[model samples]
Target chain A: MAVTAQTTKLDARKLRADFPIFEQTFHGKPLAFLDSAASSQKPRQMLDAMREFYETSYANVHRGVYQLAERATAALEGSREKVRELLNAPAAREVIFVRNATEGLNLVAYAWGLNNLGPGDIVLVTELEHHSNWVPWQYMAKKTGAEFRMLPLDEHGELDLGALDEAADGGNVKVVATGLVSNSLGTINPVEKLVAWAHERGAIFVCDAAQAAPHMTVDVQALGCDFLAISGHKMCGPSGIGAVWGRAELLERMEPFLLGGHMIRSVRFEGTTWGELPHKFEAGTAPMAEAVGFAAAIDYLHGIGFDAISAHEHELVSYALDRLAEVPGLTTYGPPADRRAGIVSFNFDDIHPHDVAQILDLEGVAIRAGHHCCQPLMQKLGVAATNRASFYLYTLPEEIDQLVDGLHKVKKVFA
Target chain B: MSDGLDSLYREIILDHYKNPRGHGVIESADAEAEGQNPLCGDEVSIYVAFGEDGETIDEVKFSGRGCAISQAATSMLTEMVQGRTATEVATLDKDELLEEIGIPLTPVRLKCAMLGLTTLKVALHKAKGTPLPEGIAGFDELDLK
Candidate 1:
């Protein structure tokens, strides 16, 4: 319970028992999973919830009058309530379910962006944004004639606050969108400070919490972000179910994207009337099973405590960074200690990232290679590509040893 | 096949990576073609000198900064194409190249390795004043001009 930052040990043995893939082997060896930033393994609870919904309580919600439909409606609406509890949103109405974080951001950008932004309106984004965060604003800029600008990064990968203030100072910027943690470098942005700055400039702040929500406690009210996006799969939930948590007033003011069946209150040949708040955003027959799975995943996280998950991940990340440094030619990217999350991106000297990934795979250790979907950040880091070995709550120190040993083997092979 | 898995990371592959063959400039080349991997910003340029037969590749060279896959693949391709007929090299398909290298590539990296092949093929076709294949997103636009 005394969660020390670096020395804490987690029993993923119990966690692994919940997810069966850990028992499997890759290339005839126990799989050393270091690609959790891409996606995390789901717990049995989430898997079971999806199956149970399909088998027993399967029905279309709100439209059907059967008892199964009543159960499905309660379950679907219940997941929204759980998301509200998870983020501590003021009401369940604030949490709008979407396909994933990308679509969620697009919903806000297309809806709010279309209405608010004009020729000179500026949207401030960070240098480390994923293409998901970067491209929407660019599309908005192209469509609405707004100017998309970047908040520059310091040497440590933190956004330059002075540049942010300068961008926001004129009050011309409509939105300040940034990621809570960079997926490539594992650099945790100072998002709370950024939110305050955006607020000062009367700019709506949006946080891409895809990487952060899995490892840290997120409170929308405390952070004071007008809109925040979270992907379920990056945590321990199923894909195709993500939530966009916005303030009730903000959600009400925004227009619905993807006009369709479930999102309307009434329809006719003439322009139909729309539903309120969350339903307005969710257009079609939603991913009912996926929503239930996500709700179950939130329960699993709360049961384990998000604080414990954070401590466990930080300890593993610290161990990984330290151990990786000893791999002779390994050069790590991103900020110093305590400035990042469980993600660790590094490169080996004179070796291509693909070679590093291949070498690691030989040792049954999995890692991600290439630009990690952040080409601009790759340009910023001055590397063509990097071999990244990210961590999660279920990861153990022995696996980090496998990565280290694998690096040594790569050095030996290429020496 | 050092570790029973035949690690796409073969000794020959590593050798090609470390001491890449046919590297650097060929100033006397008739035509040059280049390709860039947009995903990671790795660039490759293949320089060629053609024989009087218009198909025989008398000289072949390349220069690039990329993963061992791209660099080593380029090295292997240079070795394979040098002194071969440009028709032979142009007819060199992806499976044949992968077969010669004796390794499987992940879908995307396979394209990285094939960039040199495509570049070599384009250079040969360009020198002959022939038309290029359609729907090649990376280079077709550039070649169109």
Candidate 2:
């Protein structure tokens, strides 16, 4: 797919202007936002699309006969179609809308694992997984009396693929779940090879694309994963909206995660018949405007083109790694720049991550400081917490320079 | 360089953090309690020894690892409550500890500032049979009051 002419020639400085939050000065300086992994700043296009939906075409979807309801229903389904394209799923019916990636993962755990998994079955996850991906399977294993195993990372902060093969050699692995990209360490896993391994073991693969979907091109079909989950807020869309794309046959065989108004074909007093495919999974009133915003965000990302976004981020991460290495006592985690996304997690020698974050905040540089919902990963890395700086399309090279300047200030203060 | 940073990381706090007083465990302590800020992975353990009367804290010490504010606050807390009665230590307010640190804290940092006090209260409660006050130990449900 060719990128539109306008976006192919995009100037990031002008692109930054589209996000209104950038206009506001922080601490009497330009806000150097480096926390996009937590949640991305929304562009005007997404905001306007959501506002336009609520103002002009506001109505309940699917059942009402009114014109407004028809428009809303069309828009909602249209967004699903957009998501299908975004993920390169075979069909629109494979796209299931949920609250966020957490909810999407939970849905898979409940709907699929609860039914298919049993005693002696193993659900394999990695230490690199966010708590969302790890905990759901942990709960599922406990609830279903199955075994939950975690593949440990090597010293290089990359998943030990050898361990994965050894663990799956028994063929009891029912589900292989892992993240496409590590939110904390920024290591990008080889999902294509992982999916092939899972298939060879007769196990289903689930990819948590919460970090990958925003920064890279995620083609679920090309990766050949059984299920992939993505978050909307991480991709410049509104919060409380995310999607899961599953193989159509698998979605058909699995039961619904939630049951309510829109997800039923017929609800009798005694028993209820579930709706078809995606609707069966998405129960109750859906996030209509959020879905619209998600579609707009997809359009926005498409306008910029994934190739360009990936190339830009590669350069940024390379530069950031080189620049961050100059700071004394600064230690970073994750694979080298080529194997990672734009995230950089590090800590100064003696200064705690929280203190570093606090000091950096004084310079109007926003970075994340905490366990980053990867406590297991943190324990494995032998660190209490790390300061993470993540990048997005709007990030400028100068902002990274600013971050280096801020780190120097932190060193001086702690010295 | 900002005044806000100066207030948050005062010289006294940094001094205590770098060279903590009353650090290390009381090997023969009567009671001990450990607290952790799961959000930032800061941990503090407070150990206490009751005086002959078994009412006053004969010696109090803490051993843990955390940020500057948390460690310094723990060091300061051991010094502040060493000679006080267990009952008095149990009744010590969080504000008094914050005032002792003499720095304005955001809600997030307030938990760090109070980690030592919360651990001290728990240690006192365990030693002197005082009731454990709610919302003092858990950072998730820390009562800012």
lDDT of 2 by residue, A1-415 (tens): 3335343544678789889999898878899999999999999999999999999998999989999999999999999999998998999999999999999999999999999998889999999999999999999999999888999999999989888867765549999999999999999998899899889888999999999999888999899999999999999999999999999999999999997878989988999999998889988998999999999999999998887787788889999999999988999999999999989999899799989988888888999999999989999988878999999999999999999999998888789
Alpha-carbon runs more than 4 Å astray in model 2: A1-10, A169-171, B127-129, B136-145
Top TM-score model: 2
Question: What value of lDDT does candidate 2 attain over all alpha carbons?
Answer: 0.89
Residue A177, model 1, lDDT = 92
Residue A65 Cα positional deviation in candidate 1, in Å, after optimal superposition: 0.9
Identify the CAPRI category of the predicted complex in candidate 1: medium
Give DockQ per model, in order: 0.53, 0.74
- Residues forming the 10-long window of minimal summed lDDT in candidate 1 chain A: A1-10
How good is the docking of model 2, by CAPRI class? medium
